[model samples]
Target: MRWRAGVVAALAVAVLLGACGGGEEPVAATASRTPKPLPISTPTSIQQRCFVPVEGGLTTFTGPEGSTMPGAVLGEGADVAVFLHQTSAAGFCGWATYADWVASKDVKAVLVDLCGWGRSACKGGFAADAEAQVRLLVDWAREHGARRVTVVGASMGGAIALGVGQRAGADALVDLSGPAVWQGVPTAGEAAKETTVPLLLAVAPGDRGMDPPALRAAVKAAPAKHKRFVSTRGSHGWDMLNDGALTEPKWSPLAHDVLAWVKGEYRAG
Candidate 1:
């Protein structure tokens, strides 16, 4: 009887161990499973606009082709400077830092959205087809009672300004981080040869995109009567946006230099 009771107890213990092991398998499997999280999307219908006040009333105007390109118009009257948008013609935010500098010298500032970007006519991608767009805007500005028009372009837009200056006969042209030779666009060398307007070229030390040596060579080779080159201590478009505000250096000096240049520092016959 003792041997039989011991056998029964041993068998029961083995059965309990087996049941516990089996139960743990399902728990282990469930713990190993994981569900993925859903992806988030950006909103499409967000309007882009930012307002900053200056000495003069806001200069409101549409884009070249009647499209919505809102910009701030500062300065009292007559004296005007048109700030052309870069590759992305969003607002004048790219040149926002220079607003006060521009306004201080009794010069009106017009920051515009280019045709292809922002709230302009051609949305999504660049509108290289609309080469004459800047010319049209310059013409419109002059028509609206602008006495002396100075065109300022950043990066690709700078190249565009050179062309516009030639076509519209602008008083002065400023090119910030503008390439001397654009891949598909007309080069500054080409424009400079034909342009009678005074030109200011602002190049940053960190401008890898622009061939500084070639640009310098081109400037030397060009046939413009008046031309100047300024080298800064940053990357391309530094004077305009300043690497998305990563650094704290003020860019008003660039505007001051350009304004001074525009104010008869360099004049072409």
Candidate 2:
């Protein structure tokens, strides 16, 4: 009986102590403060800054396959169409060095790897390939909502540009160290007579296929009245566009002239 009473008294005391909070000033229950999360910010999409359809990349163009023409897009501005030609297996990014010119001229560039070249799965050769592939480039530009577009090419690319530019009536055409004697064009002179679009043909001083004589013949044949042949100092192909590369930032005289011609701001020659 005494043990049971003792147990009851102990239970009563515990209850009383708990109610009084052990009389230690009753430790205030501090509510944990959870800092409100800072506002999450959203960044602008890269596609907005660069071209939406195509972003910048290395030599190989990772775009669509087959007729899509594997290529990369450079700069954000537009109305200008740039079609790149291959000197070898290198990617079209090599021409990206001219982005400065493309920017200054408010131009957009599409570096193409034609059939059997770069990343293009489509197969064809030179002039024959140009007729079809160049259409793709033109169609791509049109799809992008470009109001005006030009075609720029290097080496064999230049010859292709001439073939397409003449037929397509491109806003302008830029040929950098291209050939005078392509399969169908036969001669730059012949290609020149076919189009009235503003044309700029640039050649390195000692290029094998585009020496001064050939350049003269081509220029003489250009009936645009605004056509010009700029002889520069550098290697062949697109390398001489500006200070030997599209990798270089500054605009060359060649780039300036081409841009001016495209802008319809050049004087008749």
lDDT of each: 0.63, 0.64
Q: Model 2 TM-score?
A: 0.68
Summarize candidate 1's per-residue lDDT along 152-174 as a digit string, tens digits: 88887776776556566577788
Model 2 ranges with Cα > 4 A deviation: 1-68, 123-128, 184-186, 244-248
Writing each residue's lDDT as its tens digit, candidate 2 over 1-269 gives 99999999999998898887774433433323545689975313222222233235533322333243556666656566676674667545456556435655577767766666654565334324556567667767777877777888888778878766767547788788887777644467778777688788888777775656776677777778577777778777766655642233455666666667655565554
**Number of clashing residue pairs in every model?**
1, 4
TM-score of 1: 0.67
Clashing pairs in 2: 59-91, 97-246, 97-247, 98-246
Report the error of model 1 at residue 33, Å: 34
**Ten-residue region with minimum lDDT total, candidate 2:** 43-52
True lDDT of residue 108, candidate 2: 72
